[model samples]
Target: MSQPPENFAASIKDFESWPENLVHQTTCLGVLKAHKTRLDVTEPKLFTQEAEDINVSFLELIESGPTFDNLEVSDDEELQQRLGEASRRGEDPKCRFIFIGAGSPQAPLKISRKMLVRVLSYYQVIPGYVDRLLEFDGRGYARKDMYSGFLSQTLLNHTPTMEVDYLGRSGRQLQLCYNLRSIGRTKRNHLAPCHKQWSFRHGAFHHQFDILKGTAVWITTTADLDLKKRIEKSTGKTGMREDRQFQTPEQCLKSSLTVHLLLCDWAYENLRVYFLWLDGTVEDEMYLLVHNRRIHEEYPQIYSLGDLEALRNLQEQTKGALQVLKGNIGVFSGLRDFYHGLGENDGFSLRDSCIGDISSFTRQIDNIIDETKRYLAQGQLIAKIIDARETIIFQHFQSQATEKTEQLTTNMQRHSLTVRIIVFLISIYLPATFASTIFSIDVFKYQDQDPISTSNASDPIKQLVSIPAIALDRWLQVTLPMTCLTFAAAGLWLWREDRKLRREYQTTPICTN
Candidate 1:
């Protein structure tokens, strides 16, 4: 749990008679809730850049950090005590780094560093009222001005070299690890390398640096780099309207530009991964981003951008890269089935469903691309918003598909009783149908008129009139009662069987005492 802010009430406005202070306080509470609820970084330590003068080897960082090295008793104890103290104080630690690993040379050195700052980057977009408090309390100032400025400066200074070799392999691997870790927590720009234009359209910037294995860089950016630092923006110093002037397109562009430099470094690290995944030569030109842009631009024939156009070309030129990846995963899944030798089909249907899911996902990506292009052409704020909505919709669709799949599985497993009931009814109906057919013939009148002949029933007319007529009358009278009795029996049987099945399906032992 996080404590509410002190100046919570001063920030919010327009509460139909609600006190400004109370609204502000509520906003602060919400912000705290959001911050507290964010996903924990699974890797304990957040990798950070070594000091400028100390050029530590990648292996050294990994050995020193929890990622590869065993934790030193001292560090573990110290961290435990610190956490305990913070809990007692009802406060979060300012920041701490703990060393944790030892890995083979092949794995190299990678440091795991965890800090709230990285978490806040995605989590700290406070509500309007909370934002006002952060503004009033100077927390907002620190975040936007000092934080973004420092980050921008660092990134600008170390614009990732276009050359992939400059970024060490250990760093490259860590970049991959971080991405794998972060993608679930945040919106991913996995498509960026394949489609550079995507970044520009969405105002998204991706970083691919590894702090532990290679060099870790902490970078931040503001929507307004210059204006956020202005002396006039202070609570007592300037009016709210005055502050709005600073939040302009130019400011956002400047901030984006600053982050862009850092992104370039990240991209440099990222390119190396694809290069290694592929041979020096890549089949998907989009992957050539691992090569310095200049180099590829110079040698256009050898490399290609893995954008929509490139994807189309690859589809035309050879095997579908997406299909190949899909097929490989499917085959791997089937292999697991083979090993288990489970029930019918060995997840063949599951594989097909998985392929369908992948296809839908790929199509969504294409749709986003198209939507983005349309927005760019229109060049309006509304258009941009529409594009963002489309992105959100794509994400929502994925969520819905997962939910639907779970629901389908639940329904299939739980409906056996219904199926059994249906089967039972059909079986009963088969006998009832035969009885009805026999009762439908004529012959009742002949039997009624001749007593002796009726009793003997040697003649066809007499048999038809007398025997069938009697049988038909009896059947009509008995059929309803028998049907009702059969249905009641079936229902009772099914209920018991359903209970037994349900009990077997459940895992917990029933309590007898």
Candidate 2:
């Protein structure tokens, strides 16, 4: 959590520890709350189109866990495939809204859903609003609203969605959302009838109220902005009240929705900061990959498997944040529409301060939304660049690896041929050497029987040496076993190697990529 200013910490913690019932009925900013009180306002306007759409989807939604294919999801993916095989049978999350609020309890009594409705409707916000908020009625409800559920609440019901939009004359409405686990510490605290759900209806409203909180930016619609500008001469002297008070209703919902938007604003800033951190990361990684350098000092991390995983995670987060911003447009648009509606009305009012002052605060939110989008775009661009660089590096290494493998294979084949040539040369020369040694042996030499004597001048004295002829059987005995043994040894080595390769191939898994 971004460290809140010192002024808010103690009070915020105090607000968090209150029981749901007390918190809902609490008064804050000096606004008093009456138990079981209902604001004298009409129920939220319901659109026929929404009714028709829900009528069509009513059957599917009631079937326990509707699938992504069946639900009105963000045109993205199939639930089964995206969730993986283990989660193929996953159940969709049931809506258990924890309508937490701020302020000190006026009454600490538990109320039934009927009574809860009466209390939450104190500000003219729709009763049983979460029913319409959670269901996917062929309209957007699963849309991200920054963990703050109310942003998408009145969306389906145009009347209330556009209802409670008194924003015309300093009209402020807010709804606060909390995790159920956070508010109710004990089973009894949660055991009220409000904890139960109605069949095909909303659960109990766990309204949480807030204390007087000041933000760097206060929210106001353009009407208030324009109204603040037109100065009406007041009996009081020159000071203008840009933050003027308009007595309109039993509640000011600004704090409720303010928390939601605040959470969203903080989340967007976090995302932007993350991207800024990553910008330098990719730059350093790509440099290291392509350049040879001696890093004599500490610096950002080099690329690794973790970096890839982080990149993937960042991409997913960026995409999610983008979807959230898109959905937020509805809430922001509601504010804009309210402002325009105010302009359409010719109201009689005058105030101090630049009309721009009120608007400046509200408009700050709109700018934050815009800034989120730009940062997401920049993150996306950087992600793409990293992907391209990764691809280039992979291909470069792969090509080199392939060349080395081919070269080694060629060298092996050449060595095998050279060995065979040496063996052939030995085979041809061995028999010749054996014959010469046998013939030169003195045991086989016989002295010339006839000594050199007076003989005819035409004939030279000759020495006759008897040569022993070896039998074909003896030669076959000596050579056949040797040749057979050499051939058998070569075949055995090859067979063993082939078997080993076969076993390895069977054991290894085939990679798809």
Candidate 3:
């Protein structure tokens, strides 16, 4: 085996400096061998051994090389002769399979980066592909729509470039990245709804296949036990007896594609279940809302803010589920196209049953997309209903507030009228009372200086009365200054109170809601 170029080796060294969190640690490796009509799948080995042990095993496999090199013989007779000799000698063709799994749903593995780089290099994968594989951050990548369509530039750009021979006889690689959604189990018991308690885990399925070399690798940021079991049980075993020849690289490729199809099926089933759960949850909430509306008609205080918020949250989740379904549609379509393209390019017709199965799978996925869209529409409609109910609730409260304010204003007006009548009565009686008390005092006196007799009664203006003007001037001088002082104090108090109100209004924050 040839050594990696100096620059490539240097690049691999850079990975040694990567943080521990960036490395993938848990990896499983498997080897498959084909002997004439029989296929054998070795038990997969996890990477728990020492580094030296791993390096020895890895180097041995690399030196042994692929088993289907004899397929390069163009002449049919020569190819048959070689295959016969190998079969007689019990030298079976073999392929290497690797699975890179995460430590948990939220964390990627910490596998040695150098070993990963070596494996990719042995398969003749370019540096760009290695860079992408190592640099992928699940947290960041999960936020974006990675797959739009098979022919989309986004897919093309992310897919690694592969090298092919002049005659296109070798070096064909296919890479597919897809999303998988699964429900996680929890031991905690709570009063929350089951949907709220249920945890959903999202993972990306990464697959790289070297069609001619029989080397394949699967990577995921989240561990999937179902996928692992399926791959192990179905590896190297084609269900079709007529297609059991497994000696040619094309047959191996078909088997590999079958495994991918199984993965797609698994993904589709999970999505269907998840969608149904969401639909049912939304439907339940809608029913509750309708029932609540009836109750609200009788007792308006029975409104629940939490129910409306929960409904909105469910709608958002449904929207996200719809996006996932759409992305899966693109994946299914792309795989269908890939199968056909491979058959056309290789000049060998793939199994009719296999093609039919893939076509049917694609159609089923289309049905899923349609159903998801309808569910999303229903979610939106429910959301609008919630909004309308909220509007009605708000108006009801507002009218109650208006009625209370009107009653309060009428009470205040009645109280003001009673106060004004009391003040008017006081004003009318106060001056009369003050004048009677003052005249009764000895400050003013009337005297008759001459008495009129019966004979003098005919004479007018005989009697005279004496009164003092100084008493009236003294009372006016004292009352005028006292009234002016009282008015000044009242005015000052009112001005200060108005200023305090202005200051408070300026300091307080106005609520936008």
Best-matching candidate per TM-score = 3
Ranking by lDDT: 3, 2, 1
lDDT per model, in order? Answer: 0.30, 0.34, 0.44
- Provide the lDDT at 57 for model 3: 12
| Stretches of candidate 3 exceeding 4 Å from the true structure | 1-97, 110-169, 180-191, 198-200, 213-215, 236-247, 283-298, 302-308, 341-513
Residue 351 CA error for candidate 1 (Å)? 73
Error of 3 at 163 (Å): 7.4
Off by over 4 Å in 1: 1-192, 195-458, 468-478, 489-513
TM-score of 3: 0.54
Poorest stretch of ten by lDDT in candidate 3: 31-40
TM-scores for candidates 1 onward, in order: 0.20, 0.40, 0.54
C-alpha lDDT of residue 496 in model 2 = 82
What is the Cα-based TM-score of model 2? Answer: 0.40
Ten residues in sequence with the least summed lDDT for candidate 1: 176-185
